[model samples]
Target: MIRILLVLILLLTPYHPNSITGSKDKLENQISTILSRIPSNTKTGILIYNPLTQDTIYSHNIFSPMIPASVTKVFTTATALSLMGKDYRFSTILFTDDSNIKDGTINGNLFLKGFGNATFSSEDLLHFIFKLKNLGIKEITGNIVGDDSYFDNIYYREDWIPDESANVKLPPISALVLDRNKTVSKRKRGRRTIYITENFKNPPLNIAQKFKQLIEENDISVNGVAKSGITPDNVLEIAESSVAITDLIAMINKHSDNFIAECLFKSIGAFYSGKQSNSFYSQQAIQEFIKKNNIYSINTEIVDGSGISRFDQVTVASVNGVLETMYFDLKNFESFYNSLSYAGVDGTLRNRLTDLPNGFSFRGKTGTLNSVIALTGYLMSDDKDELIITIMFEFSKGSWNFYRDIQDEIIKSLAELKKESSDF
Candidate 1:
C-alpha cells in the first residue's frame, strides 16, 4: 500500500530539469521580438532581472545612459528610505519665546519653524491654533513669523526653463511648504462666471497670512504682522507635523510631484550634511548614496530628484540595481514597493495598461519628457517571480503614447511567458 501511494505521488508531481531555463529563454525571445518592432530611429534600453533566481533574463543597451525623466524618483525615494527609516516623520514646530504666560497671552513673537515637512497643509495651521488655545495662549503680541531658514535661498533649479517654471506644479520649493507651496482662490467676475488661479509668489508670506487667519478664527488675537524671520534662541514647542516620511515618499512618486521631490531632496541633504540644505547639497548627498551602493553606470548624471531636469540620466541596469536592493531589504521592502504607482490602479499609472489581464501586480513609476519616456519598477510575474524591469526610450520623433504602447506590449509578453507541461 505504501509503494502504491508513493507511485501515485510521483505520477501527480510535474517537475522537469529544463522547465525554468526554457521558460526564461522563451520570455527573453518574446521581449526581444517586441523590441525589434520599435522604429529604427529610436533607441531603447531594457532590463528584466529576477532577484529570486539571480538571473538576467534580458538586457538591451542596459549599460547605456538614457534620460530617466521622473523615473529618477525611484532612486531618490529608495535612498531616502534607506537613509531615513520608514517611520521617520518631518516636524514643523511652532516656537514662542515666552514660556510663562498670564491668562493665555504671550508677550513675544510666535515663530513657525519648518524642518522640510512637504505635506504640511493649511488645516495643520488650524490644528496648531487649536493646540495653542488648549495651551491657554489666546494672543501673540509679536509678529507671526514664518522661519524657512532650514534651507538655502535657491528656489528653483537654474536649468529649469521659463515655461517649466511658469507651471503651478513647479512652485517655489522651500522647507516650510504649506498646501504644497501654492494656493488657488475662486473669484466671481459675473453672476454666472468663475475664475480660479494659483498664488505662489511667496511661500513664507502665504503661510504666514493663512496662519494668522486661522489663529483669528480660533478666537486667538494676533496684534502683529506676518513676515519672514528666524526663530529666537529660546522658544517653546507648540505643534508639529503629523505626517510620516513614508507618506511623503508616496506623494512624490505616486503623483510625480516635482515640488515635493525638491523639498525632500533638500531634507536629505540637510540630514546628511548637517547644515542648511540646498539643491546642490542634495545632489551631492544623492551622489554619495550612489557611491555607497555602487550604483553608478556609464554617463549617469542627475541634476534633480524629480527628473524634471533634462540633464538627469540613468542606465537601465542602474535603475534595476536600485530596485533589486529595495526588494532585498526586508525592513524597507514594503514601504519602498508600495510607494510606486500601481499599473491599472492608481497614481501616474491610473490610465495605463487598463485592459491587460496579466495575473500579476505591476508597481512602477512612469516618466515622460519631450521625446523621452521611461518606466521602471517591479513586475510580479504570473509564475510568482519578482521581476525588476526598466524600459527607457529616447526617440528622435514620436509621441509619448507611441513609446508607452511599446513598453506595455513588452510587459504583456513578459507576463504571458509559460513552460510547456510534460506528459507522463
Candidate 2:
C-alpha cells in the first residue's frame, strides 16, 4: 500500500521542465557568450526587459551614459509626439502686406514664411506660386522675400564640428529650408556623367531665388531680387503648405534625418514657450519631458536634437525608460511604435536582422557615429511576448560592422527567449 501511494504521488506531481528561471538562465548564458566576443576596451550598455511581467531579463552597465548618436531621435520624437500630439502639422505660409489684386497684379512683396517645415522643397514652393497664379496674382512689384524668423538665426549648433557644414546630411538648419538646403547640379561628359552637390549658404535666399525662377517660368513677373527678412504679423495669407508631425517623426526616426530632427526639436520649444525656437529652449523642453515622465538620468545630456553632436549622452536605462513610457501611453503609442524601422523591413533596418525566425521581428532605432553604435527598440516574438532591448557600444578601436555583429548576435539570442518555455 505504501508503494502504491508513492507511485500515485509521483504521477500527480506537476513536472515543469521549462520553468521561467531556467529559461532566463539559458537566455543569460547565450547573451554572455555573445557579449564575450566584444572587445574588452569597448564601453557597452545593454538592457532587456519584459514590460508585461515587469521582469528584467538582462542588464549590464545599463546606467552608464554613452554617446547615443542618432538614437537620440527616439527621445526627441517621442516627446514631440506626446507634447505636440501626432496630428500637429508644421506649415509654410505665403503672406502679402498688399492684398490689392487689380488685373492679376500685387503691389507689395510676397513673404514666404516658414514654420520649421523640414520637408519643404522647391516643388512645394512651385505649388505655392502656382496657387498664386490660380488666384490671379501674376505680377509682384516687390521682391519675393523669405521669412525665417520663426526660429533663431543660428543655422547649426555651436558644438557641431565645423567641417561637417558641407555634408548634405548636415545641411543648414533654418525655419525656411528648400530642397533640404541642398543644390544638385548634373552634367554629362563624353560618355560619362558627373554630379555636383553643394549646401546652400543661405537657405531662405535660395528659397526665394527658386521661387522667383518658378514664378518667371509660370509667366509671373517679379520686379525685385530675392532677399531674407522677418514677416510682419496681420498680413493677408495667400497660400500655405504643411506637413503633419506624424510624418515628420516617421522620417526623423526611420531615416535618422539630422536636419528634420533639428527642425522638429526647435519646433517643440516654440510650441511650449511661445517664443522663437532655438537649441537652448528645445533642450529645456526635452529636460522638462524627462522630469515630467520621471525618466531623468544624471548622465543624460541634450545638446542638440539629432545625436550628431558628440556632446549628447544617454544611459541605456533612460532610453529603456522612455520606451516604457511610450509603450503605456495609449494616445501616442501607436504613432511612436509604428514609426520605428522594422528589422529586415523598411527604413535604415531594411538589410538588418533578416534572419529572424518566422513571426519574430524587431522595430528599432539605430544610432551610429565614428566611435559609437547603438540600437534600441521592441522585439516581438511569435508567442506574443514583447521585449524592450537597448544595446550601445562606444569603442576607440574596431569597425562599426564588428559592433553591429555583436549586437545582432545578442539580439538573436534574446529572440530565442520564450515566455512559457525554456527550450528557446
Candidate 3:
C-alpha cells in the first residue's frame, strides 16, 4: 500500500493553472487570470451550470475522473442519508441468555452486538454500562464476546492515507466495538521514541486498573499517554464512551477527519450490503444511487467514500444535483448539509471563503493533497439565491492560489446570475 501511494505521489507533480478558455462574458477571463497565475501543472476539473436552463455554461475536464479528497464525504453522507433515513440513530445492545447474577458478580459472557452505528462513543458505552448496572449487574465472571453480525468484519479500505496519526478512538468494524471502536491515549511530557498508549476501553473506573494490571503482568510499560485508538478488535468491557455520530460528523466535516470519514464509508457499506462493501462495491452502491436519482453519471468516481483516494472524482453538476435533491427533504437534508465544514470556520474550509458578504456565504467540502485542491457545495448568493457549484483542480499541476481564484470567480458569476434573475 505504501509503495502504491508513493507511486501515486510521484505521478501527481504540481501544475499551475495556465489559462481558462470560455465565452461567458468576463467570467472566463477572470478565471483565466487566476489559472495562469497558478502553475500550469495543476490538475483542475471545472464545471459550472446555469440552473435556470439546467445547462452547463463552463466545463474543463469535467469528467476525466480525478481525486476529490474530502469532497468524497458528500457521497458518503448523502448515500448514508438515502440508505438509512436521516432520523436514524445507531444503537449498541447487550444480550445474555443466562446470567448468574450473585453478589455483584454475573457468571455469563457479556455479549456486545454491533448494529452499524458509526457514532458510538466512550461516553455512550458508559451509558450502556449504566443500563447494565440498572439491571443489577455489577461484575461478570465470564469473558466478553462482540457480535458484529450487522456488518461484515472487513475493516480498512484500500484508499486511506497511511501517514495520518492513528488512534484507538478509531476502532475496526466488528460485531462488538466500544466507543465507536476507538481506544484511549495519554499525553506524556517526554517525546520518547515510544509513546505512552493504552487500549483500555470501557468505563475508566471498571477497566483502567485492570488494564494497567494486565500490562504490568505482561511487562509492557506504558507511558500514561492520553490518546484514543483507531479501532480495536478485542473483547473488552464497555466503559465510558461519550463520542457519538453527531460528534463524529462534526469532526469529519469540520476538521476533514480522514479517519472518521473512512469509518463512515465502511459503515455505509456495512449498513446496506453487510461487510461485503469494499471500496469498489460501496462505490457501486453510491453510483447506482446517483443513477437512480438521475444525477450526472459521467462526472463522478469513488474508490473510497472519504475522497482520500486519488481515484475518487466528482463534478459541479453531481454536487449541485445532490443539493437540489436536499431541497425536498429539509430535515434530513439539513442534517447532512449542516455537517459540511463551514468555510473559514470548520473542517478543511476553515481558512477559506472567509471574507464573503453576509458573514460569507459558501458551504463546501474542501479537498487537498500534494498538488490537488477541490471545493464543492452550495453557495448562498448576495441576492439570496442558493447555487450549488464546484471548482476542482487536478493535475500533474495544481496550486492553492489557483483554486482560491477560480472559486472566487465562480462565486462572482453566481452572484451576477442572482442579480440578473432578480431584475426580471
Model 2 TM-score (2 dp): 0.90
Worst 10 residues of 3 by lDDT: 225-234
Candidate 3 lDDT over 304-353, as tens digits, reads 65665665667656766665565445456677668887776776777776
Give the TM-score of each candidate: 0.88, 0.90, 0.71
- The predictions' CA RMSDs to the true structure, in order, are 5.8, 7.3, 11.6
Q: Predictions ranked by lDDT, top down?
A: 2, 1, 3
Question: How do the residues 1-424 of candidate 2 rate in per-residue lDDT, one tens digit apiece?
Answer: 4324544654586756557568878888988888787778989999988765557888899988799999999989988998989889999999888856656888888899999898888888888877888888778898889988888778876534333432235778888888888999899999888999998888778888888888988999899888988888758898888999889988988888888999988888788788998777888888888899988478998777888877788999999988988877778888998899988888988889998766789999999988899999999876555789999999988899988888888887776556336333
lDDT of 3: 0.57
Q: Rate the local accuracy (lDDT) of all candidates.
A: 0.79, 0.84, 0.57
Using TM-score as the measure, which candidate wins?
2
Worst 10 residues of 1 by lDDT: 415-424
Question: Against the true structure, candidate 1 has what lDDT?
Answer: 0.79
Higher-lDDT candidate of 1 and 2: 2
> What overall lDDT, based on C-alpha atoms, would model 2 receive against the true structure?
0.84
Q: Model 1 misses residue 122 by how many Å?
A: 1.5
